[model samples]
Target: MSLHFDHNRPIYIQLMEHFYRKICRNELKAGDKLPSVRETAVEAGVNPNTVSRTYMEMEREAVVVSKRGQGTFVTEDQSVIQQLKETTAEQQMDVFLTTMKQIGFSEKEILDLIQKRLSALENGGDSNA
Candidate 1:
């Protein structure tokens, strides 16, 4: 739970994204119980209010559900998880494309770079090599 916070973004949003990445990677499975707010605050080195806000936002997005006297749990719906994965992927791809284009990369160049990286990974070599 060693999260490095980027001060440029809101802490709660970063916390939410951290949890989203965990869920997307299957590290936090469906119906997994999230840590208590106080626990998360301690772990993330943020205020309790930030963790609470993060949990609230996640609930609003239907990414997790809070059970009274229990705790917050990741959504059990597979469709919701699948949609989350797709949405996260699109958001990440959009960011990558925008950054590459900003650096003067054309669409074909980006596509070729991606293909080369994938081929390198498939061949068990470092993509950066």
Candidate 2:
């Protein structure tokens, strides 16, 4: 999957988040081999150092493991996956809440809006519009 880099944000953070989402979606399965830093940088139109930084940051977070000669791979630990699931959920909700707050929606209004949208979705409605 392509990394959707937001120019307004830090590239490394954005890259890391992209990988987190991919991992959480099971797109990058446990033990999946990630592209080389140079290759990923080329594909993502970024500097190799930025990609390397992203990988290193992930390694620090225990989201990926890098072998000396072999390349970086997604963590095979089940606990990591479960933790990532919760982490991704919180990140998604934080973004939603921030957007709602910025739009001047009170907490109650946002909750009500979410409930309404969820009900529509459950009833097979086109709530995207």
User: Which candidate leads in TM-score?
Assistant: 1
Model 2 lDDT tens row, 33-126: 9999999998888999999999999999999999999999999998998899998899889999999899899999999998988999989888
How far does residue 106 in candidate 1 sit from its true spot (Å)? Answer: 2.4
Which 10 consecutive residues of model 1 have the lowest summed lDDT? 120-129
Candidate that scores best on lDDT: 1
- True-vs-predicted CA distance for residue 50, candidate 1, Å: 0.5
**Local accuracy of candidate 1 as per-residue lDDT tens digits, 1-129:** 658999999999999999999999999999999999999999889999999999999999999999999999999998999999999999999999999999999999999999988998999898554
lDDT of 2: 0.92
RMSD of 2: 2.3
Deviation from native of the Cα of residue 47 in model 2, angstroms: 1.0
Off by over 4 Å in 2: 1-4, 101-109, 127-129
